[model samples]
Target: WSPYKLLTVFTFIFQTASKDGEVRLVGGQSSHEGRVEIYYGGQWGTVCDDNWDISDAKVVCRSLGYSDAVTVLLKAAYGAGSGPIMMDEVACTGNEASLMFCRSNGWRRNDCHHSEDAGVICKPNEDESGSEVEGTTHVLDRSMDFAESLKNLYETRQFCDFNISVKTNGKESETSIICTHRIILLLNVDANFMVKDGAENFTLTVDEECTPYVDDFIRYLYIKKISVTLKSSKCIHKLASMYGILELQEFCSQLFTQLLPEDLSFQNQLSLYSYALSTQDTMLADSCLQYLAWNCKAFAESEAWYQLTWDQLGNFLFRSDIVVPDEFFLLEALESWILKKGPNSPDLDKALIQMIRFPMMHPEQLFQLQFNFTLYKSHQDLFQMKTLEALEFHTVGFQNLNQYVDLSNIDYMPRIYTSPTWSYLLSGSSIYNQYNPYYRYDYQNFYSQLRSYSSSFHTPKHTSFLFQSDMIQWSFAYYESAQSCRNSGRYCYYDNYPVLLLSFESRPSSNYSIQYQNKALMICKDSYVSDIRDFKNNLVVLPSNDTSSYTFPCSSNFSYQYVVRPLYYSEFQNTQ
Candidate 1:
């Protein structure tokens, strides 16, 4: 297998080199067909027609880097040539580089009139068919050149027969392709596969993103429209702005990434994703799918999600980050969403429906659900979801606050608020949407910074703070000041779920011997907060005199370090 593959590769390279050579034609309607000319000894001369045929034309076309020759002509088909009749009776097995290299009568030895100039027409090189000579390689550099190139191509089309029509499989997908000066065709045999078989002229069918608007494209590009519709003009601009070209695909992908939630929305994201994926814009499709995954929960509940195809919905179901407590919770959400689709809802995608971790459900819970709800045939996907969910639940799963920190307040839920602070940690204060917020807090890392001798200036007068460090980066609002919250409902934290409550992430301080002091209680010591001390003061820390690291008495999970002298030492020193 290896040997065969290597031989095939070597053959291809040989063929490519054989075809890519220099040759030219003169005095014809277009570059593809004319009286054949060969340059040798630094002088140009015409081929004699004594033995001109398609075989010789094949050699000529291949030399000029065309795919093949369509026909050979006699009697100066592109009009008679003058000066030197370079060669006569040329013979080629269709592999030689130049006519001069082929068996030919010596230069200027043709015994024929200039009328027998031996012209030939070559087959179009797929994308290269309509491009003018220099235009095929080096065209305009930018927008100004794009417009000018289109005009030049339109004018030259009559001479080259370069106009082409393209159609796609669906309705409203037909369009024309016009070669312009900027239409630099990357030379390859695969590019020719788009041409329909047995077609008299080039008929190409490409992906939907590239299908031109036949009328609009030709009218705007071929014939200059004096005034076009704004919509039409925009379409024209997009098409002519290097439309259907793969070169700018990455640029477009990056553009969409920056524009999202600003210039783009979920409504347009779907369309763009489809278009980009169809056009082979890989980065764009990947980015779009990732964005969808991040907002999977909200999107699933939104009207937009129901509008999506089954395949699209399946993408979300497979994501590990879909916001759900467990497979059972996720299944319930899916069922509810499906119910909203009404009794006449289309058939559920069986493949996706089966992905629910049904078997993994606790045996008792699964049996209860089975009695109450319908079960689909999800043998594999459902199993996969079960295993994945179970693995996730055991390892890195977070349990809500019920098991840990007690938020027993009836009127006030855990209102984690942030207040502006003047500190040397980081400059500028801002709320986080989590894209790239400047403020960061980690419980373990914050604990590491504290030591037995460490101390911060005490500032109880600074009032209640959510966090305290070298500076207070975030602090909760007092109950009386709750009305000032940007969104009271959002910060209410009323959805009664808790996760690792012992974890407190905060910054802000000037304290000598720090403790979990409740400033709210200090300011409003008379407020009616039930078991108020539990919500505030009883959470103070007592540091060990000799130990540098300490653990909270409530749970071993909580680690802390405090700066304090030994209790016995403090009393003895006081006595002395």
Candidate 2:
């Protein structure tokens, strides 16, 4: 059978079979795949392929102790079987443990012929030495657990060739001396330990604060398992690094990423983030930053935000994915951070404040920030240039932005503002197909407005273009055309032909309304030619009062490579 057919068979059986039923593969080339047969009521019978699918196949495969089903097969792909077609129209939801639990026609009451038998191909066992035969059992050997066996040796002190004396200042006890293998320590734990010819004694010294983590670190070398709690993960990670156990260090990093966000408060997040940075754990640090950025609004209100150092606050403001109601919220958060920093030099304060993307802020926000903020008020001369730069970006018509301002700067890029001031960046792509002589393919991608107000509040919307909502219908479609060939002997003229259509229709009585100015800065970028920062063109969208809909005229040769962002009132002000 073809690979596709085999895969279909696997899925159908896994989803269709029952755990309580005795199932077996009859005609597969390997034990993991074949015609499915189930023993029901003291007789074996084949299943009918009525509504058989991948989900049905999954249950069958998993019931047989296989990992998963590769595909579902139908119409007796493995050849017709004898005996009754016991179960027909078997419907499995894939989560069912066995085919016996699935909804199906009464057993032995199928309206199917033997040729309509259902089959499946399951994911083969990773160990392909040979499939274990049915009706056979083998005893497992306890010595196979190498880590446990090694641990047993360590506990028994059967072959101790080295003694490690841990010193915790004046806190050392008899338990501080650990007997271990010299080669295991030299190979896995720490390779830097200098072995003095025949000297069997070794003394390792660590601060009292890290003494608690030493036992776990030493035990991990024998068992290959780390026992670290939230409070001790950092110390254990440090101990592991000191002992040259890179695997343990990585384990602690991942543990921190998982625990810091869920169990502890934002203070722990900040503390762990700082520790991760100090330890140069980029993965852990990045995870912490993402958590903070996604919850910037909440984090800003926490005591940790007020306690953040100037550098830490700058680190957050520099990120383009910081989630907040608007740039004004960011300004307020920065004001609080600055006030907490106490009195500082105007130059130093201004340098940190420069990280804000003022261009993304509303004109009103910029005006208030310029005149009302204490820092801006006290040092107007220092911030005057920033205020003017933002004002220019807002007032410059969307069409004139490239000519008047440096669009490549970070300030020009929009952050993920929850307010309707900006829509999530919309993306879709199309590729040229040369297989067919005359080809035209239509690609439709859906996206909604006002993404920040979705019910899934804490989830980050920076990377999502499709706003989660059912009240409003929002979508964009583009057609990729290779009509130049037109089946005219394949030597026709070649050119890029593409068209874009954008639509938005809100349901009647929809509670959604556009706040602030109705006009939006619809910036378009052709990703084929430039990065997201480089704009191919721009459009001013003013949804009509009756329909709340708008469309853009096709820009030839580049519509297929579109990455459009509709900046709400905040992106560009009414310069007129």
Best by lDDT: 2
TM-scores vs. true structure, each candidate: 0.32, 0.50
TM-score (C-alpha) between model 1 and the true structure = 0.32
Native-vs-model 1 lDDT? 0.42
Model 2: per-residue Cα lDDT over 276-322, one tens digit each: 78877775677677667756777888788886776777777788656
Candidate 1: segments with Cα more than 4 A from true spot? 1-159, 166-200, 204-245, 248-265, 272-282, 321-329, 341-576
Instruction: Give candidate 1's root-mean-square deviation (CA, Å).
Output: 29.1
| lDDT, model 2 | 0.58
User: Model 1 over residues 256-353: C-alpha lDDT tens digits?
Assistant: 54333322236655765675556565656666665555344445555666666666666656653232333465576666655565543334644555
Cα deviation of 188, candidate 1, in Å? 8.6
Of the candidates shown, which would achieve the greatest TM-score relative to the real structure?
2
- Candidate 2 lands at a TM-score of 0.50
User: Worst lDDT window (10 residues) for model 1?
Assistant: 523-532
